[model samples]
Target: MAEQWWRRPVLVDAALAVAVAAAVAIAIQVAGEPIERQADFLAYALGGLMGAVLLLRRRWPLAVLFATVAILLTYYSLDYPGLAPAVPLSAALFSAAVAGRFRWAILVAAAVVVGGLVARVIEFDMATLPVASAVITDAALLVSIVLLGETLRSRRERVEAEADRRVADERLRIAREMHDGLGQTIAAVNVQAGLADDVLDKNPVRAREALQVIRQSTKEALQELKTMLTVLREGSETRQPGIDQLDELLDVARKAGLRVTSMTSGEPRPMSAEVDRTVYRIVQEAVTNTIRHANATTVTVELCYAPDSLIIEVTDNGTNTQQGNTSGFGLTGMAERVSALDGRLAADFLPDGGFRVRAELRT
Candidate 1:
């Protein structure tokens, strides 16, 4: 996969370094300044090298800034004419501020620019209007660089935060699928296996039928698990079952010795992919629980499409029994999916000895 631009901040920093170096070199050459016995050569090389040091700006912002400032000061003290103070300092100040070293950048700015202004004041007799103007211009330019860097830094931070939130949301969605869809399929397989075990001696024919149900349930579960993994790990598009696949789900329950039926009402118009898939999962989980926990002889899965809403209902006339914890992630996951769509899920145990699951989604 192609790397995101933000993930490669160092590359941008490196390019900035090369640009700064070239700019500094061109400025000195154009100034027609006198070289102080090869001291000018030394100053140019060191000043230009400060730009390349920006490669570590994010890792060592304060150090890079201090190093650039010290090198520029040392270069000027070599007595080279037309040596500008803010030439190399610009890149360093920008790098530091953008690296989130606000305190360090501020401290460096105060120490350098404020100190320069105070020195000019002390030398008032020798400092002309031109000198005062240069000092003010240099200070203003440094502040501008720092301000621009901070602005970009804030934008990058906001981008990163948004990316993190998206990742978290995707994770939650995947978790719900695993719990509601795959978990119920596995549980159904367990139910079939246990039934086969119970009937092995009393009725060999019935035991074989139970084993067949287990095989089919596990096979479907494996396929669904594979799809879930593909979606999460590879980020590849995987097919999600929807209302069209409701008959297949009911077939599995029928084959497992449960009387289950599916029917649709209203002129069935198309639903959004998310809403369609959520409807399937809700019904699937309801059916699985009916067979596993509710000793139901018959269960009904129905879909109703209204002008403004899509409704789904799963009902079973069976005694709701529990071997252990009756509550599971099935209902919670369904609720979460419906809530995401601004819909509602109603799942409850009927007082007359049955269970019902109904979901209503806005069109």
Candidate 2:
């Protein structure tokens, strides 16, 4: 896998080197002064070296830039032929800039431009106007190449950052799911196990019922856990529990000895997948907390659907040991879910000795 990961870039660099070498040869042949066969061979060899050096650009961008500049300067110093600086130097300058060596690229580019201009003046004794024009054109092209490299570097960084953020978000989502799902299931199982143990010697029938609930809850929890793990490993989408599963959630709570009731008001509207899943998780986490901490016998789950938002309230008629504190992992996960949807969450002890968790989510 590691070898394969590096193969593509190596292949790309090889192709780029070939292209640059070809471009240099074409430029020299088409625009250069006529010379003997031996001199022509030497000129082409030097131009080829400029492109061949690009193979090291990714690992040694500054060195590649320097090598290209030296080769170009040497080519002109020999009075062999005149080739446009853009042909061979552009790739090296762009490579350096993209590798986060913009300063080095800029300095090398300036040196090449000045050196080429001086060589032209000394070799051909060009007029003042022509030299000025050449300088402007070369400077503009070189600057544009550097700017293009910088733009590409910026774009690549932005893309990588976005990808990292998405990975983090997904991990957080899975964590919340594991906490809410497993936590609730285990709480229910604990309640059932206790009931079974108490009734085993007194009422065999009731004890069997509690054990049945435990078996069913564990079965469902294991399946859901398997699905979540599969999604995490394969990066595939799976059907997540939504508000439609409220009945089952309430059933589990009931079997855990809590009188769970749900009430929905206003018109029921469809929600985005994320919103639906979040709503279910919020309710699940709230109920799980009640089961584990509230010591409550009755849980009232209320949903108020409005034109622009949905309000969820889970209230329990039991003592809330933590009172209004939202410090537990369960509450914190709920808050995170609500905040991600641009919503609000409030958890507080009701004045009447019960605890209430309310969340308002935008549709």
Q: Which stretches of candidate 2 lie over 4 Å from their true place?
A: 1-7, 30-41, 197-206, 226-238, 323-328
**Candidate 2, poorest ten consecutive residues by summed lDDT:** 31-40
lDDT of 2 by residue, 61-165 (tens): 999998988898788778765666697789999999999898888888788778768866986699999998998899899988998998899999999999999
- Predicted candidate 1 versus true structure: per-residue lDDT over 41-99, tens digit per residue: 77578757877788888889888899988877666566544445575677788888888
lDDT of each: 0.78, 0.87
Candidate 2 vs. true structure, TM-score: 0.88
Model 2: pairs clashing at backbone N, Cα or C within 3 Å: none
Write down the worst ten-residue block by lDDT for model 1.
31-40
